[model samples]
Target: MSLQVPRNGKVCVIGSGVAGLTFSYLLNQLRPDVHIDIYEKQERSGGWLNSHHREVNGSKVMLERGPRTLRGKSDGSIVMIDIMRRLGQLSQVQYVGKKSQANRQFLLNGQGRLVEVPKNWTQFAKFVMDPISGGLVRGMAHDLLHCKRLDRKTYEDESVGQLLARRFGSTEIGDRIISGIYHGIYAGDMNEMSSLHTGRRFVEDEMKYGSFVRGMFSGLGAKPSEILSGELMEYNRSIGGQTQHNWTEFARRVKQSAMLGFAGGLEQYPLALRAYLEKQQQVRLRLGQAVASVLPGTGQNVVVNGVHYDHVRSTLNPSAMAAIFPEIQGLQHGDFKSVSVYIMNVYVPGTNLIRDAIAGFGYLVPQRSSQGDGLLGVIFDSVVERNYLNWQTQLPRHQDDCTKMTLMVGGHYLNKGLHLDLHKCLGHVSNHLGVDLAAYNPVTQNLLARDGIPVFDVGFDKKAARVVEECTRLYAGHVTLGGVGFARGPGVPDVVMHELAAVLHA
Candidate 1:
């Protein structure tokens, strides 16, 4: 929630990345009189939303080097849409239809073969016969018919794997689908990630209604924004003072789409934020400036790089936070491990690389088989995105319709030593795409982001709370942490929600 500035407030925001920029923008809105400064070590404002444009074989293609799209029906997404519409860029909103071919999802089984996670009758028939679906039907049946609902009061936190085993009454579902889904989303082990932090409703469904399928009919559903704080809701209302579009209703409509993004790319959000925030008279963006420390000031203020401010909000990860404040390292009670990701975006002009042209969103490799070959997932970029960043002035759709995919490699599997075997990784990708690496020549860009995605391990919520408590004490209540690997989730929407809460709380 951006606040109405009470007076001449000064706040220093660390990291001009998504979280930082978001925090500044919200705070500026709520407290217009407050002078805000954003410090980013990198020259760019957006954190992992790099959209690179290139002309490949006479066709213009936009390659998203990082996160390309946002999930629909999220609290953060609604807020994001409101911000986008207010930015006067609502015309740029692009939606992939709910009935789009991109709605189909795949999972790589233990045999390392991609199979459609059945949706329609034909695919369901094939899935029933596939080895990957060996005991899935029985497991689902057990969940719907045999499993007994746990008392809501007696329920405790458990890994998603444990939930599947207990609720579904089989391990095959976990092995075949759960593992692949979590690996794609978290780049972490399904057996290790917490069910509550990842999907509380999923766990609660089995606890309260005996089964997930049954819970859909239980009439206890909640909207994504229903859980948001009243402060945030008020902030939304404040922002919506005179706008015609009801963003909540708009977001509900958007939730019907398979996915959504800007016509240019996800980077459009942050870059646009940078440009607009720069225009604000009360805002100052300190790009390319590294913060040495954020120490408590003499009286009623925080000092960031020798400048005293009423507040200093940091948007860096845990390790980055610990770097500037070593005292925070003592608060760690459990692992907050993060994984590095090696992203390879490929643009194969005029030639469809996927065998049989099996068009779907993408497939994810399960954690059980991801160690030696850590290809977390592949994005069918072209299936979801049909236009380049400058599509307004770019080549025709057919000319840009070549294979566009992104290979995300080296997460939990290779996070140990942080190694990058580009050729080896590309070989795995090309193999999945039904091509020989030696013969395939595609325009590609490789990017390695160290400790990019955080693993939401079991008990991560408790451990993160303790860390937050300790950090609050260390900073003498002058600093706050609002970034990935904290209490909030690691998704783009989560980051936005976290900062909105921070702004309201402060």
Candidate 2:
């Protein structure tokens, strides 16, 4: 039934980010009897999902300071739909269809020109001729012809750069393609990022099939059930049959779409979660209340800020966790690094600023082209959802003439100690888009020291494993990791999957 059901067990969830809130939401659903207390250091929920709403003249404009969209193809998107359907916020859901022009993603070439990433072999053949592809075609040939499997016994883990370099016979492919993707997503370095955590599938594929090319061919006939975890498959099944939610129908709606977002913005997702959790008598969201301490309590219970709980579910990063609970031996001063990103949300009304008015998702600044401006990427926020009317309102997302986008710059991974202010950064993006952004005044531009994007260095999975092993040895069963810090990736789906799995294990 509802989340208001009473329960005897008590649980504490730290950090009211996506992971903490989603964990609490799932907790009430699976075990409604357990009373939950969510602790957030910030004054609101939705961790980095901040949407700045502004009404200029007649049209409403939304600018995102953090994460903005969810890919429809990810299992996390389905999890979001399940939560949204329950929150009565499905009406706020928006879609970017697969065939939409906004789906075209670009990577900056060495000459600082935008080149559309090849979608097919015909395009790839043409694309590789350009120097920006970094001998991608030649690399693919090398992998197909000369690649050899790694020794499982010795190759426990490596950097994503190492993996790509090993297979492609050079680091060029990783530097050009994979680096940009990771930068855009994690604000991290491909050379330092863990292959065990990110490229494990490729590692396994190589070991099994000799190369990624052969691996891809071998997996051509795999079904959804085979690709997705049993837990996710079961969750989808459980929600699909729920006539009220009609998740099956919802999935059908977005399955063909490229990405999904909220009507106002992504902030709606976390706001909805907090609103729903607030209605439940069994849940308490302690926003603006930081957890000062976490220690082992009597029996199998853990104490959070002096309050005893049956279990402690932490969404805090490893460093934050180490600070709070020093007893966790292996968690001390993690090898992982944090990155500072400069996010500038630009909203220019009645003007299509893109070069030649090109309609696409936006271009990413890869490793080779990352310097000078520190522009990691640009999200064509308005362009991506073009032609898609507002949810039920049947109006364009913004004024027909308005264009919205976010510029990322000065990430520590690439430009450490680089503090390129919004003023200095405008010209770089302007040169790329062929617009004088310096002349147009915009809203919301600043540097955010976000802890959400954790830079997982090589051997991170091993370190994480050792931390878990130490926790199990030290705390017995009092503490559990669940959030961006512990998840395989910081994506919404990864967070939800890891947290829910921890709940089941706990």
Highest TM-score scorer: 2
Candidate 1 per-residue lDDT over residues 217-265, each given as its tens digit = 5653543443444644665776544333454456566566556688778
TM-scores of the candidates in the order shown: 0.87, 0.91
Write one digit per residue (lDDT tens) for candidate 2, span 58-116. 76677788887888777777778767877788778877777677788888778767788
Q: Count the backbone clashes (under 3 Å) in each candidate.
A: 8, 1
Candidate 1, residue 255: CA error in Å?
A: 2.4
- Please give the distance, in angstroms, between residue 435's alpha carbon in candidate 2 and its true position after superposition: 2.2
Specify the highest-lDDT model's number: 2
What TM-score does candidate 1 get on C-alpha atoms? 0.87
Q: Model 1's lDDT to the true fold?
A: 0.73
Stretches off by above 4 angstroms in model 2 are 1-7, 57-59, 216-229, 236-249, 355-357, 387-399, 504-506
